[model samples]
Target chain A: MNLLLLHPDQRLDGDRWRLDDRQATHVRSVLKLAEGDHCRAGLLDEGTGQAVIESIKNNEIEISFKVDSKPVFALPLNLLLALPRPKMLKRLLVDAASLGIKNIVLVNAAKVDKSYWQTPNLKGDLLREKLLLGLEQAGDPVMPRLRLAPRFRPFVEDELDQWAGPGRRLVAHPGPFPELPRGLDEPATLAIGPEGGWTPFEVALLEQQGFGCHRFGSRILRVETALPALVGALMRLP
Target chain B: MNLLLLHPDQRLDGDRWRLDDRQATHVRSVLKLAEGDHCRAGLLDEGTGQAVIESIKNNEIEISFKVDSKPVFALPLNLLLALPRPKMLKRLLVDAASLGIKNIVLVNAAKVDKSYWQTPNLKGDLLREKLLLGLEQAGDPVMPRLRLAPRFRPFVEDELDQWAGPGRRLVAHPGPFPELPRGLDEPATLAIGPEGGWTPFEVALLEQQGFGCHRFGSRILRVETALPALVGALMRLP
Candidate 1:
């Protein structure tokens, strides 16, 4: 873990915090820090700073934290993803979090296997756990909001405008099309397809919603690879 | 498989090819093609077109091949990567080829585990197999060149200059450095450090070798995530 992610509930007092369970084990074994040594740390949805080891006890470690008051900035991007397979889903969740995307909506697509919706990996807590790994990986404190849309048509036709807010609406498809437009700090929602990609009708549906389809290149990229690539293509973080 | 990859030696006669083993099984089971069916197929490092199934038998399938003469284009990017863990390596190899990267040099680094060099996945034929999967995934014909450097100092000090010929020489790090400039279709080499990133000494040495380190925001992305993100940040495919 790049940063010691402390939960809001873990605070012992105003400045002191207690760490236990997986984070405790990681600090004890992997970090191998000693008393008085400071490690980079931040609270969930809080700014990063340093935490000094106060004591190493039997079951837990006590530490004192001093963090910057600045809030972690969320990227003005919303990822509208076709639910990938379980293995790829795990990787994407971690990446989406690490990349600081503000919102992710996993919508059903034509090629998305029905079995993917039934996988345990899609469970609420399981999904949260994956996103946590991502946040810790990037040392970011903000948790991204993830929503599921099991029905593709209704979600796009009904809830997309409000969810996407106001910004660039894009669908990333194989290019020979126009280049990705320059990014604005305002919100952008990028829709990526499933394994075989979106059908013509599906593309038209999203197009009708003001989602301009853009191309990265002619070669098809795997969904996991395409997510970060397309994200990088659209914007750069400050 | 998006494209059924065929080997040149699989040709039974002038225009007919016989497919057996894993691919034949895939065409039978996953693709579920019967006699007279056609599938998108390509020869390794050759053009992609169509192959019509002429016959299906007990152990093998017979098909007639017809392919375009156009060569698959390689992205003018060389990836200088620290050897990642085996699992991550497997994913990177596939992605590198799918992204159409021309050259990848896996160099030893202070943070790279020594055991990574000894992995069976790094074996030449095994590496070839992974790249093939990537090629098949993208329906691309060209295979990326993979080289191993077991020593860090010599590889950077001795080989970096010649290896990274006539293009932008860069190292990716956590940044608020500057925005990545627009891309050109010329050769560029990007060096990415290991999981914890390069030590200060190593970064200095690379800096001395004419490598301008750039940043992709403050988020420390995983190597697998960073590779594509940086590659995307550098250049977009034509």
Candidate 2:
């Protein structure tokens, strides 16, 4: 973990906090920090600062923290992704969160397996856990908002247009579509497909909502790999 | 696997091949291919074609193939990376192959743990297995060449100049470096550091070798996340 992320509830009094869970284990075992050493710390949804180790006993570590600065601003992007397989979903959650994407909609798609929705990884707490890991990795404190839309049609037809307000709406589909645009100064909503990609009808539906189809060249990348690539490309736009 | 990769020894006749390993399992169980079913197939370092399932018996599957097209051209990019932890190394091998990067040099740095070189994942067969998985995912047949440099100084001082030929020689370092350049039609060499980043001495050595430093903005990403992002940005330059 790059940063020790503490929840609001973990506060003791004033600038003091305690951790006895995975963070504690990381501080004790991985970091091997001594009592007087300081480690980077952030409060969930709050801000980041330095935490000085005060004492350690019985597998719990107490630290005194001083809030230095608020979390980095969220990226001006939202992701509309076809729910990937369970294994890929875990990594994407972490990847997307680490990239500073604040809003994500995991919508169902034609090729998405129904069984994927039943995976324990999609459970609320489990998903949050993955997102937290991502936050720690990026040394950010803000948590991204994740919305699940198990049905494809209703979400796209009824809610997508209004939600993706006033921005470049692009869907990543493999075909002779236009290359991804550059210099996107405004917010952007990027829709990425499932493993087999979006069916034609799904592409049409998104297109009707102003989602221009774009190709990331010929090589089809796994969702885990594609998320960072696409996000990086968008972030690099002048 | 998106494509059934066939090795030379798997050939049973001019146009026929047999498989009894994991590929066979994937065909029988994951794909559930029947005798008459056809699936995409690629010959190792050769070409891609279609495979018709001829028969399935005694835990073995036989197929008829026809060479159709050569593998996709390799990306005009080379990667110089500080060896990541073992788990990330496996994914990166797959990722670099999938992205069509043909050459990779994994070098040691100050922050890289000495034990990382001892990882079983770096074993030849295991590394090849990961690359194969990547090629299959990308529907490409050619494999990437991996070079290991256990000692950093010699690799940078002696061999790097010849290896990283003309065009952009950029090292991704966090700090006051220029933004990554864009719109280049020439071959580029990208060097990425390890978890804690490159030390000043290492950066200076690379600079003396004519490597320019660039930053991928402020957010700190894991090597797996950063590789795709940087590669994507470079690919989108034009």
What TM-score do all the candidates reach, one by one? 0.94, 0.96
**Top DockQ model:** 1
Q: Write the per-residue lDDT of candidate 1 for residues A90-151, one digit (tens) a residue.
A: 99999999888969999999999999999999899999988989988888877889999999
Give the per-residue lDDT digits (tens) of candidate 2, residues B124-146: 89989999999888888888889
Candidate 1 lDDT score relative to the true structure: 0.84
* Candidate 2 chain B weakest ten by summed lDDT: B229-238
DockQ for every prediction shown:
0.67, 0.56
- Model 1 residue pairs with clashes: A45-A141, B45-B141
Residue-level lDDT of model 1, residues B94-149, one tens digit each, is 88988888799998899998888888888899889888888888778777889998
Per-candidate RMSD, Å:
2.0, 1.7
Residue-wise C-alpha lDDT for candidate 2, range A1-238, written one tens digit per residue: 8989999899999999998579888998899998999999998898999999999996889999978998775788989999999998889999888888888999999999999999988899988988888888888899999989999999999999987887889998887888877535579999999988899999999999999988777886888988988877776522
Backbone clash pairs for candidate 2 read: B183-B237
Once model 2 is optimally superposed onto the true structure by TM-score, how far is the C-alpha of residue B29 displaced, in angstroms? 1.9
Residue B26's lDDT in candidate 1: 91
iRMSD values, candidates in order: 1.5, 3.0
Candidate 1 chain B weakest ten by summed lDDT: B175-184
Worst 10 residues of 1 chain A by lDDT: A175-184
